[model samples]
Target: MLVAGTTRTAEIEGISAAGADSDLLVHTPSADAEILTYGEPIRAPVVPVSPSGCPTPAVVTRAVRELIGLDVTVVDGGLAEPTGAPTVTVGARPGDDVREQDPVSTAPGVLAAAREFGRAVPDDEVYLAETIPGGTTTAFGVLRALGETPTVSSSLPENPLELKQEVVRDGLTASSLEPGDAAGDPADALRRMGDPVLATITGLLVGLVEGDTAVTLAGGTQLLAAAALARHAGVETTLRLATTSFVAGDESVDLETAARALNVDLTVTDPGFENRDHPAMDAYVAGEAKEGVGMGGALALADAAGVPMEDVRERIVTVYDRLLDGRDPAEPQP
Candidate 1:
């Protein structure tokens, strides 16, 4: 199973089915392996040199090629280069300005595409992940709108916590003002601020389902958000939480909390991140990331694709280990 969309600085996470050692594994496609990438500046303030998008591309591509033992195809869906070399060049900077449509429509489009792909895949199962930067904030926004205190921040709730506070307030304010204009459409919001990848993911999911492959969504907050939306909209899917991501702190997004809200059982893959050497866990402490929605999802797909869990774990451990070794990708790039 493979699914990847929604990435931010570092693309820290991908997707997953469960935490550690689950039956059906999940994973996400890397930018290098993606059919393509797309996005437009939505006036959201972004930082320079912050390393945007998921970090799984190199790992996922490497792991898939080595573990799954195949040279996967890579394609572009129009927005090949959006004035940014990966999300690292233009960071979302954790703010409300970064917008993505509700994905109500986009989800269907992605699902449609995914359904088709699912039938083509040799496996009978499928997994999904997201690549939305600042997607955590959006998840908080959606959750809060649904009337859940999903976040708690000491400094006004932290990055996404604060972001959610603002968004929820704005959404509430908008609803109060409009009182009838559908308040706001997540799809429109995504279109205005969301990257093209979001739509692509949804389309893939839709297509895969049409193909008859059993589906398990993988990702941290975004997947949860998408699952909630899909379920509410009558989209049938088996949901799983890729437990390997450090994208969301337990305090901020328990996912369990979100699942309870929807009255759904969230299956998970592996709990490998519990190891002291896990890079994702360290990323959170380093303040580089606060959620693993994407990471969780990506790992799941890797597992399903038959990538050895040890190899996946080793790859992540090494990536961060490499970083700690002072070997930066930006070492002059000579």
Candidate 2:
């Protein structure tokens, strides 16, 4: 179709109301990013800070879609039925299966669009891509609720058990609930967040794999969570795309843990980043980096896309700095 589903998280820590719509996602959209919403949101991701420590899905989707030249259709994707996104039929239920369009879960409106491109130009391999912010939080919530170990503990994870527990703890705290990390079943997690953008991406993964032309997952932790779900459901796939590889084993976001749960072979290029953001590094160390703002995953996607990493980094950091430090967002940067 035009492109895969384009999703943005709405999370503003201070005022949850801010995330009640796609405002937060639009807050940090890429230079070419567009804003498409139906009306308002109910429960969305909220990032109170201006620089938006996390990369909004709005920004990531716009950038990725621009690079690949795909039309973006924004869906509310709020907890309730969405009215913003284009109507794409996902003629299947949400479960653990590498389903083709013939039978799949949560299909984006664009899949049918992409498939047509394939038919017209069968020679060229075309597929879907996605971006969702604040998804890792949902992942943690899902796994912990499912009673499985979550792997995204630290901004950098070393031990999965500890990491999973930590993520569970944070999620529990954020939701103002008691800490729980008991691995029992997946239904709990799925009921809580399985239907999120993660579900859509997993659907994309299966949708692309069964037919032809590999799919490229364009974000981090959330991709790992989706991959893990695929593995757990016994979906067989070999993510051949470089972007796919980057998500399966990234230490930065518990990709391995997510993959382990999924039981698939989603490999990644090592040391995913060619350059380091000392300032961001300092922020993480200073305990400032928040999940779902989308810096690491955006950087990873930039890497997979072969773009100048600094340009992407500068856009994010500069935009954020100007917005947060009371500088004019319209002012030019040095």
Candidate that scores best on TM-score? 1
How many clashes (backbone N, Cα, C below 3 Å) per candidate?
Answer: 90, 24
lDDT of 1 by residue, 116-203 (tens): 5544756565555444334555454444444444432211123444445555455545434221222134333333333334434444
What is the C-alpha RMSD, rounded to one decimal, of candidate 2? 9.5
Error of model 1, residue 109, in angstroms: 6.8
Which residue runs does candidate 1 get wrong by more than 4 Å? Answer: 1-65, 69-123, 142-159, 167-196, 245-249, 269-281, 284-294, 298-311, 317-326, 329-334
- CA RMSD per model (angstroms): 9.7, 9.5
Clashes in predicted model 2: 24
User: Residue 289 error for model 2, in Å?
Assistant: 5.3
In TM-score terms, candidate 2 sits at 0.50
Where model 2 places Cα greater than 4 Å from the true spot, the runs are 1-76, 79-134, 145-147, 153-189, 192-195, 240-254, 257-306, 311-334
